[model samples]
Target: MQEAVIGLSHLFMTVFLCCFANFMVIPAITDVTMAALCPGKDKCSLAIYITGVQQAIIGLGSLVMPLVGKLSDTYGRKFMLTLPITFSIFPLVILAYSRTKWYFYAYYVLKTLIAMVTEGSVQFLALAYVADNVEESRRGSVFGIMSGFASSSFVFGNVSTRFLSTSATFQVAAAKSVIALLYMMVFLPESVVKYRTESTETDCLLEKPPTKTWKLFKTLPSVNDIICLLRTSPTFSKAAVVAFFSNMADVGLHASLMYYLKAQFHFNKDQFADLMIIVGIAGSISQITLTPILTPLIGDEKMLSTGLFFSCAHMIILSVAWAPWVPYAAAMISIVATFAQPCLRSIASKQTGPSEQGKAQGCITGICSFANIVSHLAFSPLTALFLSDNAPFRI
Candidate 1:
């Protein structure tokens, strides 16, 4: 009962804190990029470059995710999870306190490197923990609840940004993560045990003893391990494909949306924050109510694909938004489109046996990291060029 409670609470708070930090940062990323790269006018190109550079650095860091995931398999989740979360703290504080261009550069380097260790894995680890604990048939609802936790927290984060300064938001976000780290250290239990370790055959009685804490640091899974899993597992392969494309769209959207909207619609921070709040509500409500009902009825794959189709629609609507209200209108698409990621995660978790969940989720995270590099680079330049005065279309 205590373990269950810990897992549930951990997921809820971790999702909330992560979403809070994320929402806190979304409005600021563009501004920070501008401040770091170009103080006055001519900010667009440098901002784009900063965004691309950040993603590229994180992409390099992401190479460790699969290894970390596999390490969770060998060393255990608690050790794997704690180090990244600890590494995460200082960077947030550094970013919050940034006053100079050099501070910005330091923040960027620390963020890119620190985040590479935890970026794709935190939520993945939480989801993997769910898979470790819950029964197979009911995992979708749990995943949805987790997603809803994120969205709901995003709603709160948006509210904070409405009144708070960028520095305040970053500080509060850092504090929230600190609370989470303390909570995990005190209460969270290891979901994986020696007897329950994943293996190829049934009646698999082979379980390696937990590696020593120092030894855990050196035990890293290679890129080949990730590739071999993809090559060997058909279900994992298909899920990886869906995750790749879906993340391509998501990463591209995240990197470009704020810059695009502010450039075209002249949205200030408050306006951008409100748009996100609306989108969050739409997703939160849907994932909480609609996805659970739909996942069991239509199946995760079909539901995921449907969500992706609507995601494409959401992007298209944003592209040609003619009026201020149009962006808000596009937010309604999130009602259905919110199903994509959680569903993909559920599908992937279901494909793997108990032992392989960490590896699988880590691979998905690695795919996301790779896609982030590509999408940020691709979208930053394109969005900048499109919004430039010299552009042909004049968006």
Candidate 2:
């Protein structure tokens, strides 16, 4: 029963709220609030500036995650895990009330700060729960089940946001987040053993003197060991690189794919929502159906590689902007990528010590966030250069 609870604890409805709120708002605002944020004569050019700012903020979060990891080590994990979710309230409130460029600036800065918190404690703590409670062999399956639940929210949230009024849509998301908070307060159980020692030597040493707080951070494997681990451990590097490039493809798509559809097909709110739903469906299916079947056959290493291959292929197809089945093809590629993500995380978990799960996951996610920042910075110019109306592809 405890195992079952631990497996399901991480999938609070609020996890969906955290991501869905951004998805529902960002794409729509790329033309509106983002334009206000930029306030230039050219709307698309303005969006580039907004993207740059957002990426800069996300990059800041990536920079701050190591600190959050250090805090998780010293202060405990639960509070840090809950901090970001509460911090999300500011942006949701701003989105509810704001109407001007200054509001956009204030809101963006605040949201960026809070968003950083999610990577270290917010995400890691839940996985840490699994690490504490679940046995070695079953970790992958538990993670898969969690991913499926978490990914399902994307499908529903996208579909709901498409039909709901702007205020109502954001309100529902806020409500979902509040409920997730309540659930965590009441039902989520912590499984980590406080003040654990790996062996008798540490136990005796603890009797002699307590270790300095800084020592915990310092005691982590040296830079050389990290390199050696990566060089010999194909699994970690494979998972990390796969995660990086797959996220890069996603950033490229999110940066311009909606605009592409709007330009090519005259898609409106409802249609855009439907297109997003398709992507979510494909992604959820990947996490739900594809990874389970493929992981066993291809193994985690090839699974990560295969996922990256399909995701990159999809991005290539999207960049071409051909007619007919472009959206569907892109959706299929994302599905495969989402399917493989858990496998990557599971493989990564297998390579690291149980005590360092929070730090390891934090590092992996930090790298992905860095990749996202780089892609966001690069994609704006790339899209402007390749897909802008003045360019050769004008159509």
Number of the top candidate by lDDT? 1
lDDT of each: 0.76, 0.61
lDDT of 2 by residue, 1-395 (tens): 34564456544444554555555664355444534754443335556656656765676577555455435544455655667767666676776675477777787777777776564345555565565566655556556655665667767777887788766666666676666676666665544534344442112111212233556555443445445546655667777786677777677677766655655665555666676678778777776566656666667767666776776787777777678467765676677766566767787777655455555566577667888788888887766565455676564
TM-score per prediction, in order, is 0.90, 0.82
lDDT of 1 by residue, 327-387 (tens): 9999989999999999889977876667667777888888878878778778878877887
CA displacement after TM-score superposition, residue 289 of candidate 1 (Å): 2.0
- Model 1: colliding residue pairs: 198-355
lDDT of 2: 0.61
lDDT of 1: 0.76
Error of 2 at 98 (Å): 3.1
> What is the clash count for each candidate, in the order shown?
1, 1
TM-score, structure 1 vs. true: 0.90
